[model samples]
Target: MANVLEPYLYLQEQHGFGQNKKSSAPGEEGSDGKRDGEESSDEDNQAPKEENDDNEDEDGKSGSSSSDDDSEDPELAKLLRENSESPSSSDNDEQPRSQPADTERKGKGRFIHQEYDSPAGNISILMIACWTMRFPVMYMDFVRLIEAYELPYLDSLRLLPPSLTLHLTKQNIQALSPHFAPTPMHMHRLTSRLAKLMFRSYNILTPECNAAPLLWRAVRGLQGNPTLYTLTKQLAHTLSLTLTIHYSLAPKLKKLKTRDPEHHKYDNAPPEVSLAATVIVVLKLVYGLDGRKRTPKDIHDPACALPNLSEYLIAIKELEERERKSKTSILSASSTSSALDMDNDMLDDYLDFCEKALLPRENRNIEHGVIRDYFPLTRHSSTPDEGVRSEVFEDSLPDAMSAVRIHENSSDLGPGNAYAIYHTQDVLGSLPEDYEKIVNRAATWAGVEEDYVCGVVERFERRLAGWWDKVRREKAETLGRVDDEVCRICIGQLIQHD
Candidate 1:
């Protein structure tokens, strides 16, 4: 009782309990005297009989009113009461609103890029495996096998050591060669066509050069055969302007003098002037206006001179007039028509030159007295510029020049200082007799000479049989020298000489 009374007394002293201020609870008004009076009156009206009953009722009312005063207002209390009410247990199992699929989470299951460490020794081994066997028969067999096996074996094989990958790739190519023979003539035509296509592809001017190396390699490979090179070179000379323009190798009306400054054509001419001027001079020569009238008797090169020089000069004069007018109305409709007509004429002349050699017929030949200026023609066989010719031909030729011989001059075979690493009795001695027959048959089918193939196989067998013996015989320092030599040879072998 004391403790309870003490707390009540503290509240009364601290907060004026009897004479109320604002009531804090729900359904209760701010209490000055009015609210207290109203509460008392309500209690009085309820049941007033005995003094003891009245006291008990008043005390009960006071406690109830205080509790009520501590609670929220009715509106707020109603809201909170509704919120506090627990949702039905069944609501826990209710379905929710549909959600969008998580694309990023779903996409994580795809392939990833991984790097593998490779040693220089491994790279050297791979270089030998792939390139030393130049168009080796194993390559053809492997390619054919891929057709049979698909890429499953191949993808897995490359994932192995790099040398193994190279060996497998070579085998694949060798196998596929029969299926894709690519005859020399057809290859030539294909390369020429591809070169023309590359000339037209705008991608060359773009930032990416992905296709250039491929195109260049194909063309180089096609040109590897000599006959193809001759055909293209001849085409270049006779129809120089037209062909260059056709391939867009030369800009229209742009001069192209030789890079050599001492050449007569390059005397103080503006950079743009040489290319166009050279083309014009060549064209003039082709048209018989280079101070020479080639008659039908001049049948050595008919494509050079068609009509007489005067007629060609007159035509050029007319073309020059059109060129002058083109500058004023460039890119306009009229100028465009004139330009097209001129291009068409040039193309026609170029085509005629290509179809027939520039030689006149016997009937048009000059009698002993015909006074025509003699123009000495240089033989096409001789290269005018040795430096340029060598560079260009070296890139295209199948044979290497003496200066650039890529293959190391192998000394007459020194004693084959053969050494084996793995144990032999465990590997070779245990092989069944049938293995030789299988290997022999495979080698035969792959186009290797039986004796040579057998030699390599026997060498391998020997290595397996006497591995420990060989290892014991060779000192570690000597082995190091041998390894260094092997590496140099392997690297040297990769150079494509031809």
Candidate 2:
């Protein structure tokens, strides 16, 4: 046994492990020119030396340096010594010691450290894997793989990382091509997954998130392909439904006060509406229907040959109409009539009481239109002179004409004559004492009460003004767009005579 251990000891000595037992500066030579321990002079002895006993064996193994020695192999020990003395190792050596072993192990199971790669690289790998296996990969699984790789959600998934995009495009073309004869279910799964992933990148509030370019490319590449057309239409349909739901819920949301003190804002429309609107606009632009020259003839032209263009147009029109009606309904509720005819009659009676009891004779002659003219149309105006006259004219003209026509047509007095007759009474009631006497004399000559004449005129004036304003607003919003070429086309179509 001793003979066998002698060879092991010789091997360790040859590898420089034997030199570790003596105290001497590294590479220092003794006076006799041999590397070995030697007593130093007073100046060299001033430097402290580590207290390590080579004679004490803790592990019951002879020739062991120390129980705390990090390296057991002679070569490893030399390398570690060299590394510790290097300049680069100084930073690492100065770092704080690691946490206690128990502390580090406590929460180690909760998290995992994963390596990340660019979205393109990961997607390419996934595509290759799926193609090699010739099996349909679940969308959720694909999403999971993306998440596992910690890839960013790229909006340009359909056109990015040339290799992956080319593969996807090739697969799509083959699936849609008649020559390929691919399995329908397999094709459906693959395309559906791709669509879902592409759509996922679309965020309504993020202005940069746009899927239109990719979609347009797909349409152009697969032009005249029924499968592609159906897919595109389905996407548009989904967006339409989303827009409808948002519009429907907008009015019902509670009004929120914004930072502006004068204006009360509401969180009515969702962010999804912006996304849906953008997509619709992009689709229109893609088909060339968004141009100023768009017309019924252009829309119906067979030469255009854009698949689902008509359906998209119709869907967009319907959405716009629905949105318009919803907005109009809300405006009508707050700014216009909300009561039935019966309620109006009751309100009229109340106004009559106020006119007779509270209004002085001098103040009665002040016309409603004249009073309205002195007020600004909106709160931002500093002067009432801006729109007063126009508003007064808009309010009073049409009702006056209708009242006069009714008076000329009616042979007998009845509820049908109430508007004309009451208006005359109101006017007479408001007249000054001097005008009253003149009006009374004229009424007596005409064989009618002065009050009756005044009331009929007043009622007729009020009705005419209200109706005129309504018609003006409607015309401004509809037929008034003569400067816009698109509007001109639409109007020309409606008014065109055969």
Candidate 3:
């Protein structure tokens, strides 16, 4: 339920906008219209040094912050104690790490400002109450599962925060200026890449594995992937750009004349469903291999069951054109007046702010280091007595990895080879010693070089994958047709399960 009228302004008797700011506003410069109080430094312009919360581990996942001194803030101290006691906070390096408290820190004398937040991320949680529980429920002891394959770092800076592009505010409208605009390339690269990967990697994340992707994908993209749902919703973002450069938004998508069928039932279909159908059209119109080309057959493809998408695509195209014309008319009217410069200036700022908030990479030049995407996976130095785990890249991971297990009774491969098979559970091959020290220790106990042991592990890994595949299928069948809302909560609990 969206508010028809947002940013409710205060009455004259109430706390007017900026009333909390000391004395008068900035524009009230000495009768002459100059910036007031500039000679005296205003603390508002000076950004306070905010402490970054991301403390990354060797596996590149955000770990507990080492800033554990309790005496500074009693409130924080109490929080730390509580978190330490929480079951979800894990000691295992590979398990889900404890999230730091989300306290908004401020410097001394800093004014209290309402930090911007979005509900799109929490929408899945909201639907929990509405669910009938008809969908299959997943069952897994997450604590054990994560301890086995620290999955928290699987996507890194791979999902965008919901945009405020459509929810423009009075202050944001002023951001239309060129000075406030963001780099076109920055906006496209960060938003596009993160969204696609978040969707395309569906079912690829592995067994009892991560709940993040499923939670995000479900109830997204009109009962499909989110690539289109989000993209279409933000189509208004193109209006934020300069008219001269708007061509860059979707240069490859040529305007095509699509005909409306007279008796099509899709014309009366749900707005969201119709909008989703149009995404494939735009994908096909794009001149590159980026989105590939989507077609009517795609809806009926075994991979996708969107039976009605073929008809609804027409509705989406009409909706897109209507929105464009309506928004463009509003802007054109503004451009004809004295407010033209101001409107353009505000759009620039809006784009810049929106980009910084949504992008997971290079945010504020990564100064606060809030996002933990590129933190290097730590490698350990090993002594002869304690064997070393092999060096591995966190980014490049194989599709199938062997799970670590030492079958004492089975003679399939010697204990050493079996131990090696067990360690390859994750794509990066179980993360290094935190990938598991027992693995390194076991190999040493087997009295062989890890290189030789690894050779044996590789030979049996393919055969072991078949066993893992069957396990995943049985689990999926047992928990048939999972409800999207349930997946989010389950994963949410798993994340908290330490």
Candidate 4:
């Protein structure tokens, strides 16, 4: 199987995953078509060393003599004179720092920031398998199902690469006029086995699987697409409802006070449905899809931006209703076949959980809501009215005008206002005023200890910080040689602050 997959994997490798193209090699001709060798001059070569020497001298002078010290003191006078006479002494004490090897070699190699591309490439493989095996059905029929069900096709496809699109189309076309078509029974059996295999291989049912990247791509692709944005919000809401069920039922699974003889009847573990639903919700929320709005189009219009989305939503609502009805019937029915009973019981439990969870807390007479209430909506509202704003371009106000505007806006600001918006202090300060309260509330809603919630939040913050640091480092390393302003913005100020 590995050997069979090697060719497909190699093909994916050639495209360098889903990343933007690797930047041009260092020491090569730049965007202006000037070679690095040609761009260098005697003045340019001498300037950095000269600047470093001046900086070192200034540092030595400042460190050796402070204005607060008595200039007439014998020890202070001696130290100042020695520092003035031997600037090299101070330079030597400040160890000769070497530039990072990674900084120098960053864009020189073929694999610049390769990790960013890995997720898309990896998920594409799973998507390809689904496409080739027709586990759910042919791509066309799947699209038709989307149309019938009213799912967002373009938004989903935007998350996938063009390669997958081509493959799906080709495979579907071939299947339509194939040499022969399989009988319905054979097709069903094949699809069932393939679907099972794919799920197992991808570990879709397991909590250990890292589906974050795939979810990220899906959410990222929602930019500029209002139809997809609306669909994602609906999906997110559905996921939230599913999570509510899991939290509500978790405590009821075990009752310490119950001594009834019929207690054993309720001892069975909760269905995996809640866990599955939670995973879906977490992935979507983590990847920045959480909001609400009305559907953008009428359901029946053939030319609607998102054709069948209304029908798909309606179908989902109907299914939920049917599931609710079935749960009531199944709970009351007294069938004793264990296999049949277990399957029906699991489905019924899951449906009941979702139905109960979706209702408002006040309406349902619940004292607590879900964990979602603690967090802000991950999705941002679109800025449709405003055109693009430029910082230092022709479209921007002149520097003098900009400075005046800033002065006017920040007239009452303190020294802290000087910090950049992305600075650590500013970022951390932006958190909710009652951070512990929110954490505790969420923990109570999720039926977990506050400490566990705090731990998760800390870990997530650490990971986010690390991610941002890596991005900043990469951006700094790739700073252009020709642009001093760019260098100052990307590297100089960042390094000085650090």
Q: Count the clashes in each prediction.
A: 33, 26, 25, 3
- Best-to-worst order by TM-score is 4, 1, 2, 3
Summing lDDT over every window of 10 consecutive residues in candidate 3, give the lowest-scoring window: 238-247
TM-score of each: 0.17, 0.16, 0.16, 0.18
User: Which scores greater on TM-score, model 1 or model 3?
Assistant: 1
Q: Please give, for residues 141-162, the per-residue lDDT of candidate 4 as tens digits.
A: 2323232222322224433455
Q: Write one digit per residue (lDDT tens) for candidate 1, span 127-224.
A: 22332233211222332333233222222332345555465576454432233222222322333333345557743321111222322332232222
lDDT of each: 0.32, 0.34, 0.29, 0.33
Model 1 residue runs over 4 Å out of place are 1-154, 157-229, 236-498
Q: How big is the positional error of residue 474 in model 3, measured in Å on the Cα after superposition?
A: 4.1
> After superposing candidate 4, which stretches have Cα over 4 Å from the reference?
1-408, 411-433, 480-498
| Candidate 1: C-alpha lDDT | 0.32
Per-residue accuracy of model 3 over 1-498 as CA lDDT, tens digit each: 236334333221221223222222323432222234235333332311111222211223333334633325788667867766745444554242332222223422132221111111222222221122322111111212222222221122233343644565755434221121122223223323333343356522111212233233222322223433333233212211111111222223233345532222222221212222233222222211122223222121221222223333333334333323332222321223233433443343333433444455545463443233344222234442332122122111212222223333443322111222333334464333322232233232222334433433333333334433554455556677445444433323211211
Q: What is the descending lDDT order?
A: 2, 4, 1, 3
Question: Which candidate, 2 or 3, has the higher lDDT?
Answer: 2
Count: clashes, candidate 1: 33
The better candidate by lDDT, 1 or 4, is 4
TM-score of candidate 2 relative to the true fold:
0.16
